[model samples]
Target: MSGRKTGALLVLVLLALLGACSPAPECSSHQDCPPGQLCLSNRCQPGSPADGAADAGADPGRDAGADPGSDGADAGADPAGDAGADAGADAGADTGADPGADAAGDTGADAGDEAADSGPGDCLDPDGDGYGTGTSCLGPDCAPDDAERHPGAPELCNGLDDDCDGVPDQGGVCPQANPYLWVFLLAGQSNMVGLGVNSELGGADASGVNNVHIFCDLSVHNDGNPHCLHWVTPLVPGFGVLPDRFGPELSFGRRLHELWPNRSLAIIKIAEGGTALADRWAARDGDLYQLLVQQVTTQMNDLHIAWSPRLVAFVWMQGESDACSSDTANAYYLNLRNFIQALRQDLGVDLLPITAGLIADQPMWPEAGKVRDATSLLADHLGPMDVVETTDLPRHPDDLAHYDTAGQLELGRRFAEAVNALLADRDWEFPGDFSRAQGDGFWRYQACQGASCSLLSWDLFRRYWKNASATVLIGDGWVQPAESQAAEISWWAPWDGRIQVTASAVLAASGGDGTMVSIFRNERLLAGPRPLTAGSGASFDLLLDVEQGQRLRFITDSGSTADGELDRTTWQITVHMSRVAGD
Candidate 1:
């Protein structure tokens, strides 16, 4: 037979087999049957493919069964059909060997096919931690032990790798360290959490600073240690620590670095949005204060962060929270004083200076006089403390609180100013302001061995002169006393220089134990202390051409500590230096 005839016969055989397997049509309803088939009840009945005619009494299945081609017997029936039928029968006999083993009729594939389908013997290996021997389709690979899944254990607070092997919080558990680190605890309420923006601070081109790391609590009362930080009043306008972001501009510390240019700083911020001083930070006995303590302690412990070098200052930007509270402005001052004292105790610093942000001038705090008075009282009462006035900065519309990015940055700068001022005070040696000092040199006053008081080193100081707090005494009791011997020293302007030195101080001691001021040039005592009079500080200026290398010191001969305040002294000195040539 020609190949074409064989192909046609094979196609015919397939059609017959498919026709035999189809279900008999049932007639249920009129729509169930072909248009020509009448629905006796509700079943669909068979009909001709076209014209809606019924092929009555025709049987395709039976036709195929009776033909010699159907039983695989006729030579003209198509050998391909015969071959397929033989293959089916052979497959039935084995029930396992595949019929597609090979079209070329080779059984070599039998062993390979069996091997390819075989699974491991019985040994569990789930995560492929390697040494398992198993034989089951669902054996080791699909076993629970073979996989490392994130089950999200409940031991998030223990700070341990709770789930067995090596890592903690691996499976939906808390991460060994949350990727969202560098958190700033946002307390208070809307202000600290943020009231958002009227417009972008630096416009679309403005990029936010990450210096003030921010984190937040899940809810206001959430006990979970939040890793988010929310800034109080941002330094730059847009620099507040938000939900999952920080903005406005740079933070106080960032600006601090800019001003100092040589200091390392970190910010552990925690400002509440709508918190009040009396409510949020009352005392440890108070609910809000306790909450703050817990947060601060937990963060420090969990992250093992030490508050030093890094913890340069505490920024308190709260009065608004307490503005309308029962704590009157005076009470606010009292509470703030206690809070400051508590913070110092907790932080283990004798004088942890704080920079308090004053309520900006606006409608919310229209008459900020109270706020100012309260803050001023706190600053004055609190030792080594200062204030960052918001009076000069722009305020939000509500004016009750908050600022735009520019206002925020200015606030940050002010905060930084307070801090730098504190630092500068601590250094305490500059004659005038740091901004205007002559030749980068310091006038070191050394009271080494009684009568030898003198201006010594600038870059280095001997152990005896290393006392950063070098105060001069006038009298036996901080005033001129009878028969008291006062030590004085001085250094002449290297050239014919005019020094503008201003001294304003109070003599806390009694009697002849008073201080004296003097100037010396080339071994010639040009002038002597016109007595820094009792109870009042004195100032003196003498236009004398103290040549280079001239020496100066205070000399007193009328007071004795034998019957007066021992070491009765403390004089605050501030001196300004400039070239006579006026460069």
Candidate 2:
């Protein structure tokens, strides 16, 4: 036959063989077909481009079957999968070699919430530590195949993040001598378990901060230790009750670092949403209270062996829940006092400097004032204690009780400052009782149109005047001048001699002309009339000589546009001095 005819004859024979075979059936998904068929173009065809190896990251069951969904639902054979595992619903449920997980049976991964799709490896944890083994384990665990190599574990000579503090091998000598970790303990309800979104944080803040660490229980009401967290990780956003949200810890830790950059800081936080101090945080038989005790004790115990762990501060931001209940509000003072005492006892620290944030006076809780009063009274009784005033702190526009991101950050800064002051032990003058400084007292709040300023009553100073914002104390007790007028917070020099002045200011308006902030010794200008634009700020540190009974004032003027209307200037002024030569 001719070459063409022979080709046709062979083609005819191939056609005949093809016609004898059964037609491929249509399929919506891989599950709709039997083994040996691929759902291609809606048809169960003979060849599947995707084999079991392609789904190696699927649930630890019989991943040999190519299942696109469910935990190892495929029964089809996968020659390419690691360890001849069956993905069958029954017989193939476990990895044939080592149960559901990889060969070592310890990768802490679920089909949900884990990174997927890498070629099969151990990914299992052979040891009992709550982390997976192998490099491909659930987290960024170096030496994942080894149980002794997780975060917070003792730093071995292994070139890994043995302590799991982002750096491998202690970031230096194996657990260097006196790696003193400055510890801060945080306790409270939803406010402490902050609701601020991570995305709201600026630049590098969205990632973990260096040298600052966090170990927290983000869950609510769990009796034992919480899960899904490392022993300790670089302090990052998402340590709040919500996995992706963060609390004041971010700001608090960062501020502490800013204040004393050389010290290594760690924050151990355990907080829940909507928890009450009178009940949930009571010193007696409180589950959360007990858990807080356990977590802190456990952390201290764990670190004390190899680290010089110093508990520097205890910060509390509770009471909103209590504020909603009359009985809780009434009992708040004693409850808080006992709670602090018990925490001190359990943590084995006495007279620890404590800072608690006062709930904002909002309509969410009618008894909020009672709780605030209790905090004030508690402070009077507890010598090394202080309160953070938050009445004017901003909250989410849509939520009455919850603080927004900016509010959360400010709360942290205030807590840091309070703790810093207690530790400094200087007779510096600021608002230790952070509740608004009495207008009738040394710190006076007043308003001015141009140069003529008159003091307003505390009530007028706290409330809007002339249909505009008043000169008021805001988050962390920073005073903000009104948008419609220049404002002043004046103080009388208590002694004669050189005085150290530390002050800062930031624009605090949604939209505005900037403001000119000035500090004057009576009529003598000391600093500023310096301009501050939106989201921008200036800090002043000065040593000025003054006579006793001098009228010193921190003042804000309208911006260069000279329009005081809608220019919000927020500032803090602190004065520190020694007694003059003979009082």
Candidate 3:
């Protein structure tokens, strides 16, 4: 029992007490734990990291007393038992919620996202016709049942059927056949001959035809043919320049075909530039009147195919030639009357319709005022005639006497519109009461050859023939008993200055009879209305003389046969006023 033995025993007891109270090894974090230990609450627990075993300090057998709630371990005094209880409590807390539930929620949210991405997609068709889903909706039928369905269409001249289907250019209802036939004779200077327009050798495919042929004496051989009257007879399609392509874009016949697709039509064109009003074409005994008669007769033969085609209309474009002579201007109306009479006698139809074109654009055209004044007077008297306004077009396109392609086309279209308007009405207003004494003077026509020729005033600027068979009106005039009648009108005007002339006609009826009317000015003889007649009536007007004159005369071959008494007997005339020196 000595002091050495006592000291050793005390040390042993102290060591054991210390070991019981000490905690497990310290660890910075779970990663700082050894291979077989886990860092729990900043201390290394005694257990394999893989098994999640309890620490040495948490061993149940090392507890001092049995715990009330501990599964099989002491709960008081022993730190190991307390540790095990804490571990169990944490495990229970973790078990209360499903660990996979949050993961499942994330997976479901992801699924939802995928579904949203897979929902309705875009609908469009490409590589189709220009009218596909992405482009304008062109189709086989231009007019669709639902216009809203085809929203991407350009409402312009794209020439596309803006509704989905097949072809482009498919349009509306087809045109019906027109019982009446309208024949327009277009003749003028370079503009009438068609210049500056791209020319070709193709032919037009018009819709309706009453077998009526077209006769033209246009320049053919030369690059710019001046005058070449070949193939004298009326030929199918036509002779001279084929208007289909070898002319300006505004081909009169072509436009007529489109405007009146179902109407029977025949056009006779004989125009030359630089030809004076007193040239052969103007002279009654010259080639102009003779050729016109021949061609008109040929047209009549074709018109007879389905009952002779009533000479419905005529167009005249000239004046630059005689514009230098004032006498020609005043005598224009008288000359025109002679032409109408000749046509009526030759054709044997009721009314020889006429529509005169006035020159007003190019200043290079001599005596434009005289031409305008004369034409204006004619319009004032001629009810059925159409005086188209050309002042709207550009002053010049290229040539001195010709309009551009666009201008020409527009001109043709306007002319067609005017004709259509006139055809709608039946009454013919003839130009008349023309007296060429001074610049705006009066002329007296004394009966010389057969009948007494004189002037009879009717409407404003209109005149009737007294004991005369044929007479010329500036505008349009109704012929008595339109059918089966003949009139030969001769005209003369004293000129001292400058003038210009234009002419046209209209057939009043077709189903019944026939009549004839001729026009003449000095030696110049323009177009003549062949022998035509009908129960109804017909009329005509002309600017056959575009010049200054002093005296004017008219001689007719037929007149008003009412109750066997010549009631209205007189010649109608219109003259452009000019106070120039010799005019």
Instruction: Estimate the Cα RMSD of every predicted model relative to the unseen true structure.
Output: 40.8, 30.0, 43.6
lDDT per residue, candidate 1, 366-461, as tens digits? 345676678876675454567767767665666536665566656656777776675443222222322111112223243333323333222222
lDDT of all predictions: 0.39, 0.59, 0.38
Model 3, C-alpha of 461: deviation from truth (Å): 11
lDDT of 2 by residue, 456-530 (tens): 543435433231343432323444555455667665443333455677777766466777776654443344456
Error of 2 at 533 (Å): 66
Q: What residue runs in model 1 are displaced by over 4 Å at the alpha carbon?
A: 1-190, 196-199, 203-205, 208-250, 260-262, 301-310, 325-327, 362-367, 398-400, 429-562, 565-583
RMSD of 1: 40.8
* Candidate no. 1 TM-score: 0.40
Locate the minimum summed-lDDT window of 10 residues in model 2.
103-112
Q: lDDT by residue for model 3 over 436-547, one digit each (tens)?
A: 2111112232323322223333432334333234333222333332112223332222212222222233344444333334443321122232233333222332222122
Each candidate structure's TM-score, on Cα atoms with residue i matched to residue i, is 0.40, 0.43, 0.39
Number of clashes in model 1?
85
Winner by lDDT: 2
